[model samples]
Target: MVTLGVDGLVSGLDTTSIITNLMSVEAQPQTLLKSQLSATQAKATAYRTVNTRFDAIRSAAEALTSTSLAAARSASSTNSTVTASATSSAVDGSSVSFRVEQLATAKQVTSLEKWSSPTARADEQPKPVWPIKVLDSTGATVGSIVIPANATLTDAVSAINASGYGVHATIVQLAANQFRLQVSSDGTGTDGARTLQGADETADDPQSQTVGTAESGFQRSRDAVNAQISIDGTGYVRESSTNTFADLMTGVSVTVSKADPTATSPTTISVGVDGSAIAAKVKALVDAANGALGVIKGYTVSTAGSAVATLQGDRALVQLGDSVMDAVSSAIGGKSLSTLGLQLNKDGTLSFDSGKFTATLASDPTTVNRLLSGVPATTTDGVTTAAVPGFADKIAALAKAASNSSTGTLVQLANGRDTLANAIQDKIDGWDIRLANRKDTLTKQFTALETALSTIKNQASWLSSQINQLYNPNKSS
Candidate 1:
């Protein structure tokens, strides 16, 4: 057996192992730095999310400043319900009549007139004749004619048109096929009505019996009705002709053209207003203050022994909530509901005093507007930007200071939230890039160390083999 002491080679392997261990140990600081970077990035992301949500609450609080619930709900149209009367009447000279009914009822009306078959009124006897005369321009005696009773008006018009007279005749259909004839002068003042002959008997000679003129008597009338309604206990009159109401409140319109007056009872219509739709548009100087107070309160909450403490104590969330709520709470104009005939409850709901509201409205509506619009009177020391924490001034400053697309205070808040989120993301991206570079460097160094260890192991093995061959005396022989 060839004796070979392997302590040296084993020691070399141990040394290589020690170098690999040292590499791993040296990379620990890099790993720790990466973990710290990751934690910082996560914190930034969390804060950004909080900032975005904080702004949303601000918007929701602002929506509460819309027109009062009653004002919004009162916006609607008026309806009409009228009953017509059924009776016959004459329309003589200049006479007009309108029908009226109970405010919520419908009425029906009708009229009538009569005519003989052709030329006589309904009261005329059979074989009767109508008086008609013909005259020249000089009023000279020309002719006379008679139209027999029981003749249809249509036949009389046709006969007159066919006659070789200086006048033309036409029938007017007053209703379905009901006829009445009208005559007109065919020539200028003197030439017209000069061709009529005369009628001395029931069967007059056609040559000289034509009438110089025609006469008829007719009249008709029908009844019309309207409805009346009382709004807020005050009577409001409306015509049955149209159904529309305007400007019950600002930014509101209503139309009511349809109603069933024949129904036993009146129908009630409903209208609703969406406060949330306009919430963000309201000024919220007061809300911001209260929200900030809440944040301060929440931060002081203590966790019990068994319960885990929440991260709600973060100073950023506290400051953000305080900033938004305080801004709204300290806004100018009427901050409390009492100024507008409404009372705020502890739970944040408003109670309306209808009588007081109406009285105040009746006396002065400008006050109401001032109370709602946040436009403070000169006597009132309006809210200042400082009262709302730094929010009001900050937002105004941001709006004026920002050169971006956002110009309004609300837009500034949104832009700020976006900027915060982007900042957090940028930090994360930067950290990721740094970690990736560090990881790459560490990987390359470790790979090189592994290659060096392998080369040294191979060289040690070859040297040991050469030493064994050189010392082998039998192999040389």
Candidate 2:
């Protein structure tokens, strides 16, 4: 019934220290569990790092398989007066010569009699007659504009713009008090020409009213004209409504900047393959593969005086590195990475030679394209047979298999490590609880022992005092 932890009070012994020492011996298994947990966590971290490198390589491989690489072309113009652009459909190494004769013109008209006051109040000005009819090139009515009775030249211009007949109207100031309403076609071409008719039908004498001519209100400035160009020679000429001629050449758009029909020389437009761009894409793939190789080597290789890497001797990581190297060394269409100027090093990494690759691309471009992008083969009966996959295709598949979240090798390994670490932590926690209970029980036992020892000592001291008194009976009363 003694209170707990009251140790060595009467017996003069360090019972608490003795109990702590015993518990420390019992905690050995818990310390081992903690060490195992730390190792498992480290392994998981290493796997995640490798997975990141795999993702980068996968992205690069995907880019190498794009269709744009096969259709890359560049076009250049010799003369500044002409510019051209080529698309994927353009034929490589093709050239064309052409001279721009004339540029398309838009129809523009200005007011013959300038309005005296441009900034005059709209309420005090006499507006032009309402319902100005708009006409096209064929003298057919297209639309009409109606202005308010007391509107200024600016107001009338705004009304004309809102008519929605493919005509734009603006008020141009000539002098301090001189202003005119200018109207022009919204497009360039003979078909885009516009004419305005403001004949006063409401007047009793309709013949006296005029509209489009200078006597009425507006005067013609420039008439719409078509564009003209001569191809190869002056005997063959082409005409268009706009300067941009897309039909003149297949997959090539020619934009004329100036008109010089009489010029002796014509602008030469040349379309050809863009070798530098294709080489850059190949370099990216090589770099990504090297990056993945470096990550794998960092974990697998060992150094003196340093702790072994977490992934050292790990079979999964070792196999992954081997697979990547094998893909590079394997042949596609009897052509390996060496043919493309990519060399496999002794350390399982890739080295790229830009100069050699560029030369190979220029000399045998078709073969290079076929090797990187595997060609499809068919049997004699026209039935599809086994198709050869490119090196990039093989690497992409390997990356996906190794990094997949659900069933990938690295992902599974990381998940297993996490599970084992959690289990070990649980065991460590259990040991903590058991040790605390043991310490409490030991403290209670020691407290009881101390109480009993104190009682026995008191009893012995009392008995000795009684015996002394008995022996000295008459010495002191």
Candidate 3:
């Protein structure tokens, strides 16, 4: 992309200035193209800004229609020992109490006699045969591990660990060189109790690994026990394999951490709807509406003596704020939005009164939810009417229509502006090439003229010299 603008060589003319002026005149169309591109880009940016606000409004408005907000609930316990949680299906005003009688216990046991070596040595023990079987409380063989024959205590621990049917075993050191086998259940339930079936032992046989039943002299450290709880001071007891009780009440889960066998004073449990949460969501919608209106005003509003805006007099964006206002300003079930603490201001923005809204929600929560979303069909007097959409529904649909990526009005408008800007830039680029070519042609023409003029001047000087020499030749002779 080289360019040349040379001065006159022989004609003494300013070729550079001449070519520059001509190119300036020829580039007028490109100047106009650049101006158009800048305008189109500004308009596209304005559209994107408005579209972003519209999307935010859509999200906030749609949130008010969520069922979770309509009946959002929370649960609490009076005592830390008894914690509770409520689900979506939980009733709003249900209260229940439970007295934890006993906590579930896992089966734990230890061998009575210490393992000792057959050499009567102080620091060794006899190794047992392979495949020691373990049985649960119901006498069902849970697992059998074929460990290496003549296994060590650690090897025996590994063998018991390999028996993966809810049994874990470890070696306990009671004193110097005095070790015993301790086995515990992995789960807390009466059904999870385990018995280590091993070689029988007699007093005469010190090395015989007798690890069967209590007859084999084993101490039960803790028995596998079920959790027990009484409901509302009832004498009847409810048993559970685990501490967590999910079926005690509808949509309620209670987990007990301590036991109070005497049902004297029980922990209180309460469940209720979240009023503040609902109010906050409503406030969010109002704030989002305000934001959208603010963006629109910034783009459309102009004072009497102020400069024009990028999107001034834009009908689509001008009507956007009004449309959203109209969608949300309508009454719900014969009640105006003012009653719900969402007010339309004189400047066409939304203002929220959180205190008043929360008060209204506290008094008539059902109506509040209905105003935000919509209620089911109702028959009044004698006419049956279908369900009516509410402010949230209307605003959500409107904002979605204006901001949806595939078919949104502002999105497509911005895209069109971008396309037009790109086309204008293309034309400007073409004009640039044309102007450069024109400058190069002018420079070549000037250079060629300078060469021709120099040749004619040389020929004229030679002719004058020849005439002088010929005329003065006789005089010289």
Candidate 4:
């Protein structure tokens, strides 16, 4: 029969194994929670990075707004030179003139190559001529024309205009019946190729004309105004085109050319912040941020295909997502993005009412600028104030808010998470400590039980031997 000690030994071993396994099951949640918290922190960091880029681009755009450049034109008659004066609000408002010895000019052609052959419909009578394509110095097709055999210059102009390939045909009457064909460009940029084909009724068959580019009046030369500048009462000599004048003045681009031999004309082309472009850039950034925010706000578990396993309904995630929206909405300037004419759409995109925005800017540029720079926390004198009132202040606040260090939300989340993690860690630590102790205790109990069992068994053996010897009679002595 089994002894009590043996039965106890079997029970202790089974209990130890079961308890250890139960402890592991209880610790599972803490491990998973730590990972979730880490993911939340990562998402926050990504949002902050995108937010920072938006702020940077917006600031750059704003600074460029309202800046303007002015230029003065002058030309020298004696030297065929041109000069211009460039100035800006920030630069010294003083005018400086320089001598331009030469004006930028390009070669122009009085006539484009005529197409010896004309394309005719099948129903039309056969015309034994081919159309020619005209090219400029760069071998680009500037125009094309068709001519009947031995056609006069008068006939050529009429034919070119009728072709409708964009080149204008004009005949200059210099001498009696001495007509020169003039072909002008239809658009900007360098001229293109002029080619001839088919037969000229009176001459040899028309071969392709050698492509030639006429010189343009525009030249690459120094600005006559700054050709010589008295910098601190000293003169600086310059050559070439007025683009050099651009280098002298901040934000001024001058086209230098000869107005006449006696005067060098420098025209200062105004270069200012394209308000439209700046506004567009601002709208794009806001739109992008809104897209991301909208997606997060409307996140649905239905998209995940398993309602029971969805993270969309998680309270922690929802709270975190709301915080992200609040941060952005609160950071933007004025009453809201909507107040600035940026409206959100259902598909998570933003559209700017350009007409409304333009009207606001035109009516009060400064007010618009200030609105763009700040958040609307309150209203005063019929104007909404920003949550962060000034451009400089807004930038500083955003920087502070986005910091991942001790004072930032990231740090707070991390610390809070660490607190939760530490709690779980503490539990795990306690479990480890308990496990060690339990394991040690079980080892001792098992060892003690085994020793007792051995002793009992030995005692039983001795008792049985004595019983048998006594029962055998002669064997007992």
Candidate 5:
């Protein structure tokens, strides 16, 4: 329907205002839908907010379960370049010193002869040559690179690199137009060494490329050498193919980046128990638990002031907060959470006593660890016992179940609310079209009424004039 531009042409009434007021009443349903959409969107956002805190709790709990946290050893080296890491198996308060004998190196060789151009020329034209055979130290063929059509130094480099046989080839330009082929093993030590060989004196044949020549034809630039370090004040020495020496001590990984054979300086490594670091992890768990609980409380509880609790009347969300608190306050192995410096406050939030935790950890670390991580149930002779979930593990399980991406309860709740909000928005959008059409129809009806009124007024005026003329036709003055 089209709208009439005229507003009450003869009725002398404000038709546009009337139509607007009528449309306002007609849009009651849409008004209600808009309210519903806002509330539903808020609910979705609140659910995700709670889920975010729950995810944080899950991460902190998982950190507690890690071996890295349990072992909690700190290692340092006197030399700044060398780095060492200690695993759970490493003994606390252990120290070791070692002298760097030499660093690991790869086997490298260069072409004995220089070439005028990178590409080979036969009969004054580019030609193909035999492939460069890469033989291991034991003379076993490990890799081979064939010369491409119109072979050039770039071709050889690409072929050797793409072969993926753990070797790198480069064309070294000693000077402009004086290029030589340089090949090196990608790996260090004797085990990674390879010997390059080409056709033996086949210059007259089609394979006349003397670039990567036969064995003994190339200059041995560098030999594959292993990394060696001597134990301080002891004759015992260790060697590794790579820069890392993982077995020098139990649970200790040592990596040497620099070595000075003639220097008397020795790198001293000390591994010590990191009690403070472990305590910090427990504190993080407590903080995360408190954070999740606070979010839950804010959403579920109403206050004296006028902040609306979006989820105040929700029963499930209330239960979620209660479950998290229970997970924190519950006992493990008949031991209260205070044993780990975790205490529940009156306001339903968790508090961490770091000093108490550190003391407990120092007194009995093994038992403390068990309380954080649950004990698996043992079965014998058809008898089964339930496993006891420890504090961290239990909280982790609950939070994970509530915050997991695919199946978390809170995740699904938020997703469901979002779906509902989307549907409500669709209804609201539909009203925009309906209201426009209704206004057009109302305006057209008023325009038609004005046209009919104008015709009636003209007819009435004509009738009065004709009656007067008939009554006084001969009495004109």
Candidate 6:
């Protein structure tokens, strides 16, 4: 069908402008639906943002309520030569004094004879048997290496290194065309010494001389010794294979870097509660809570001439904020959050007073701990009363409830909004089809009207012409 326009040829009417005006009026409802859909999408995005904040707050709360918080300990050593570290299992407020008598040493050995050159031509050098035997501190033949005939000194060094006897071998060049093979124990201890000998010719003792060329004879270079330390005066002495002493004390490890047997002073190792660290963790919890509250406030605020708040008049967000505030204000161990330096502000968020918190920690740290993490309540009667939940516990529970995917408030609200928006979009689509059909019908009707008017005008003009011809026929002759 032809589309009617402003210049109707025979009807002399502005049909195009009229149809456009009517279509504009018909599209009002669809425009409103689209606006509502945009607002719903924005609201869903806002809810997701708030949900992320809630997750952060939840994690912070979990950290505050963990057992590690209460068991935290820090260790310090008075002497720089001594390094100490403690775990959560370490006893708090425990101190020990110890004197370093000796540090553990590793055993090393070097070839008794020096070679002319390490990288000399292998075929020119006198090679030992097919393989050489390596022995441990116990004089047992532990491993063997193959020194192929006519191989260089570097090859011998590589073979000795490949022998799995807990020893490392290297070629030490002394001067031009002069090198010595040195082997050392991989571990520091009296039991870590190693020896090398000819294959199938080892004596019963490690110190026994072996039959080989002067260049292949191994001699002791360094002696291995165990570490010795005296703790709490000379009454208690501890011995270790390595410089690091772990079993001397529970949950504490001390590494001895140097020996000072003649020194009159002993290194003091102090183990105590890490109050500042614990306080900082509590402050983190407060900060996270405030951040969550700030997000809620930002998305719910309604300012004049400003963009509409996505979560404006959202009861779920309002209730969530209120719940968090309630948790903060809740009493733990009969003490309010203000007592712990977490003060509530007028804008429904928390502010941490570092000075006050530090003072509280300095004065009575146990009280602060008990307040943040409550103890088991004493029962007065046989009907046992439940333990009081701490601020962190309450906050964690609230956040968990709000962020639960299956039944969370934000999730449910977002789902509901999505459903409504989809339904509205379906309605808008239907209206699109209906409006197109209506416009097509109108265009067809106007086209038909124009065709009828054109036919009538042509008939009227023909009749007038015929009547003139009939009346003026005699004049024409």
As for TM-score, the candidate ahead, 3 or 6, is: 6
Question: Which prediction has the highest TM-score against the true structure?
Answer: 6
Worst 10 residues of 1 by lDDT: 86-95
In angstroms, the error of model 6 at 281 is 1.7
The CA lDDT at 175 in model 5 is 89
lDDT string, candidate 5, 205-299, tens digits: 22553333355556889999999998888978899988999857888889999886666677899987677888899888888888888888788
Worst 10 residues of 2 by lDDT: 201-210
Best of the candidates, lDDT: 5
Model 6, range 1-477, lDDT digits (tens) per residue?
Answer: 357754578888788876778888988888898898888888888887888788887888887774856677778899999998888888877888988889998888776567788866433433333466666666676777777766787887787777777778888887886777787888787767665565434355325555433225556678788898888665688887789999456788999999997778888898877767777788888888888888898899888999867788678898899898888777776788898788778878788887787788768877776677666667786777778777777888888887778787777777788888889889989999988988888788788888999999999999998998889857656
What stretches of model 3 exceed 4 Å from their correct place?
1-7, 11-21, 66-70, 102-228, 233-244, 302-308, 327-330, 345-348, 375-382, 386-388, 460-477
Cα displacement (angstroms), candidate 4, residue 333, comes to: 12
> Least lDDT summed over 10 consecutive residues: which range in candidate 3?
118-127
Model 1, runs deviating above 4 Å: 1-477
Winner of 1 and 5 under TM-score:
5
Candidate 5 wrong stretches, greater than 4 Å: 59-102, 110-186, 198-215, 228-239, 246-253, 257-291, 297-309, 312-315, 322-326, 329-363, 375-388, 400-441, 471-477
lDDT of each: 0.40, 0.78, 0.77, 0.45, 0.81, 0.78
How are the candidates ranked when ordered by TM-score, highest leading?
6, 3, 5, 2, 4, 1
Model 1: per-residue Cα lDDT over 300-369, one tens digit each: 3445653322334655455544443333344334344454445434643334455565565546655544
Q: Superposing all C-alpha atoms, what RMSD in Å does each candidate have to the true structure?
A: 20.3, 8.3, 7.3, 17.2, 7.0, 6.0
TM-score of each model, in listed order: 0.34, 0.63, 0.69, 0.43, 0.66, 0.72
Query: How high a TM-score does candidate 5 get?
Result: 0.66
